[model samples]
Target: MKEVKIESVFQVYEGILELPEDLQELMQKAIEARQKAYAPYSKFYVGVALLLDNNEVVLGSNQENASYPSGLCAERTAIYYAGAQYPKAKILKMAITAASQLRTTLEPIPPCGACRQSISEYEIRQKSPIEMYFMGERGKVVRSYSLSNLLPLIFDKSQL
Candidate 1:
């Protein structure tokens, strides 16, 4: 029997100031999008912003529903919008931020498994890596990983 280990690779930036100009702008847009989040249930507002190759930025905020599952994450919302509006464009980067109702969640919020898969699909479709940046309400950038980092061993369309 052979034992194999999988490693996750990522880079951590000191803060938003260290990000590229366009990425910093996208991150700021994600923060601003938080205000529009409809999170009556979780009280956890999440915002996502995506940068497309055509120099277009798309923003999305979490929308909650009473039924729970019907609600969608900001990442998926923004990504889906990009797919519908800019099908041919490649996704370059994504920034995400989250806040809690009680207090600012100081911990960096990670995406749910489902959202990771959704983002992975787009990355595969575009045949390009999508850089993901995430931070908490206030802290150093918690995590920054490429699309390949989050969805290693992904089943691409070629699998079918």
Candidate 2:
């Protein structure tokens, strides 16, 4: 038998000030969006802001429901809106942030499995990588150059 290994690398930034101006703005917008999240059930508010190639910014906030499954994540909400509004525009960067009423989640918050796959689909369609910035309520952040870094061995159309 043969063994193989895969490694993922990302950068962690101390605070929002460490990010570039555009990324900093995106992070701020994400934080603002989080404030609008309707997370009465979980009280875990999440927000996402995406920067398109055309320099347009799109924002989304998590919307929860009593049924639970009816809710959509902030990442997907923003991504879908970007896709619908600017179908031809390529996504350049995305910033995600989360807050909770219970406690401060200090670590960078990553996307869920479905959101990762959704992001990967756009990456493939755009024929380029989408930089991701993940931030926590306390200001800690992590940056990834590509969705593949978070979703390695992704199941894409290429496999078919």
Candidate 3:
């Protein structure tokens, strides 16, 4: 039997300025969206912004429900909205940010497992990678990585 290997790449940045201006704008929108999160339960508000190839920006905020499992993440919310509103457009990139008790947290906001999987679907559907960005309360724009990098060995329709 032969062993298969998969690898991914990510680059940490001092801030969004290190990247393209468009990416910087996306991150800013994500941070602004954080203010609208409805996360009373966890106090961990997350915001997501998707940049469509058509030059549209979609925003999402974590919505919590009385029943924990019923709630959806910001990433999915934004992705779903983008899919519904701009069905034919490709999602070029996404930026996510989080806050707590009126202040941003120190740690970079990472997408949940389910978010990663959901994002993987778009990557496969679009036949292109979706670049993702995240930041911490310290205003450090930690890193950027492709969805494939985060969800390697993903189970797509190919498995069905």
Candidate 4:
């Protein structure tokens, strides 16, 4: 049998200051949203800000429910809101920031599997890549050029 390989490539930035002006602004917005996150149980707050083709900046903060799986992630929260508010607009970029109240998180924190899949749907629907930038409280940031970079073998509508 022949062996195959799959690679997920991304750039590492020392800090938010190294990013472009637009990205810096986007990240700042995400950080602000993160502060508003309701994550009393986990104490791990996450925020996401989306930049759409319509020039609108949409923000989302993780909302948790004591009822376990009832809560939604910040990524989906922002994306779904964007989809409903501007169905015709395409998503251009997404900035994500996560922090833990218990400690100082300094490393990049990638999106959970569910978030990746949810983002892949939008990427496919828009027929374009959704640039993603993710990081923790204040430190190194990771930049994925596309959602495919994060979720290589995405389960899309084509499968169903």
Find the candidate with the highest lDDT and give its number: 4
Candidate 4: give the clashing pairs: none
Instruction: Report lDDT per candidate.
Output: 0.85, 0.93, 0.84, 0.95
Summarize candidate 1's per-residue lDDT along 1-160 as a digit string, tens digits. 9998777877777788987787788889999998799999888999999989999999999999999889999999999999999999998888999999889777667678889889889988887888898887756665555766866777767888
- Give stretches of model 1 more than 4 Å off: 143-145, 158-160
Q: Which candidate, 2 or 3, would have the higher TM-score against the true structure?
A: 2
Candidate 3 accuracy as lDDT: 0.84
Q: Runs in model 4 with CA error above 4 Å?
A: none
lDDT of 3 by residue, 20-99 (tens): 79888888899888888888888888888998999999999889988988899999999999999999999998999887
TM-score of every prediction relative to native: 0.92, 0.97, 0.90, 0.98
Report clash pairs, candidate 1.
none
Ranking by TM-score: 4, 2, 1, 3
lDDT of 1: 0.85
Q: What ordering of candidates by lDDT runs from best to worst?
A: 4, 2, 1, 3
What tens digits encode model 2's per-residue C-alpha lDDT throughout 1-160? 9999999999999999998887899999999998999999999999999999999999999999999988999999999999999999999999999989999989999999999999999999999999999987866899999999999989999898
Worst 10 residues of 4 by lDDT: 61-70
Task: Write model 4 residue lDDT over 85-104, tens digit each, in one string.
Answer: 99999999999999998999
